[model samples]
Target: MKIRSFFTAILTALFGIFYLPSANAHALYVFAQYDGQVLSGKSYYSDMAPAAATYFEVFRSGIEEPILTGKTDVLGAFNIAVPDAPNTTLKVVVEGEEGHKVSVVADRTMVSNSSNDNFMLLREDIAHLKDKIYLHDILGGIGYIVGIAGLIAWLNSRKIKQGAK
Candidate 1:
């Protein structure tokens, strides 16, 4: 019985060790828009937490050189005045200190909105939407949970049967 309890504790600890990293892990995402002249936006993690003080780089599409570099404010907000170039493609990259990086591409249509209010409305629209959720992925996770529970139950039943024998 003591050996079983010890093994159970070890198994639980091992499971925790393997699960904690992914469970706590966050994927970074940056969303930016240019309202005709000023490019501005925010960076956030998977949990919708602000990615504050992160460095951001702006690049022209198909150009290897960064056009501008800036850092987010305390609220994860950033703004930079851009040229009045219409139909330009811009790429924005936000880098986190923990080696996490997220990039977003903005085309003319994205930033050509006349006012900041329009840009902000677009941001709010995106913010309200949920991230992509695949049906198969969810089903697979459910299957894994059910399988693990069944295996544990089977092992317990086997122990009971053996003890009765």
Candidate 2:
């Protein structure tokens, strides 16, 4: 026991001294848009080796502070809704496993969009409502009840099979 403790202490000290910290450089994304335009944002982590978990962060340019940061949902998209836009840049950053990643995200692709550009209507003033629909709003109370019942039935069937085995 004494020898084991001594060897463990020596190994720990050696590792602490020899382990070099890696500082990977990542580029910031810059976006341009017209003033007074409400912007919708969506981002996902891309380019990582197999068996590695994907992690990312989205932020505004210049200040280096994050506007939104989180794990992606079922759609693998972290969506953000901005109130206004003018000379703003949206940033996307992805890091993997203590930043020792197989693919280094050290570049940017710039895409320009005019905020005043109308999707459908010719005039920009009528851009507020452009074919928008919510799933919850459409489904209503009956839809929710049916969805719950289906989920319960599926779970119970799975549990029953497990028990049979």
Candidate 3:
């Protein structure tokens, strides 16, 4: 009985450690908008840190090679003059350190007619939303921990019963 309890405890601890969220949750994000002439956007990590000096590539739809390549500024921002290719989609990919990467798609219609102020406001709203950790996320983690603990307990009980026979 004592050995079973110890094993159960160890299994629970391992599951808890593995399932709990960490700082590096692989939540890299890239957002971009095209305003007729220029394409601009930002790249950020889950903690809202700027992915400064990160390499970025822009590829047109149906093209295998990148049409433009550059690095983000200190604020995780980039701007490039997009060739006037109407009705074509452009994909912006940002690659950060430690294998972190993300992509966003932009077309001529994204911000071509919108005002600059509106675009900034939309960007700020998106960034704020991305930084949030919802209550459901916490509850889901707890549920996983509980479920793993219950499974470990059940398996331990079955092993003890089999040993008795």
TM-score of each: 0.63, 0.29, 0.70
Q: Which stretches of candidate 1 lie over 4 Å from their true place?
A: 1-23, 107-115, 132-140, 144-165
At residue 31, candidate 2 shows an lDDT of: 20
- The best candidate by TM-score is 3
lDDT of 1 by residue, 54-162 (tens): 9999997677999899999987888899786656778899998689998988534344435567666677457535543345765677678668877998999999999
User: What digit string (tens of lDDT, one per residue) describes model 3 on residues 65-137?
Assistant: 9999999999888888987786688999988998987888964544445567566568857775976667687
List the global CA lDDT of all models.
0.75, 0.40, 0.79
Instruction: Predict model 3's lDDT versus the native.
Output: 0.79
| Candidate 1: 10-residue stretch with minimal lDDT | 106-115
lDDT winner, 1 or 3: 3
Candidate 1's C-alpha lDDT? 0.75
- Which candidate number has the best lDDT? 3
Q: Give the C-alpha miss distance for residue 92 in model 2, angstroms.
A: 1.1
What is the lDDT for 117 in model 1?
Answer: 72
Query: For each candidate, how many residue pairs have backbone atoms clashing (under 3 Å)?
Result: 0, 0, 0
User: lDDT tens string, model 2, 50-101?
Assistant: 2223455555657677665444344332333444445656555544444432
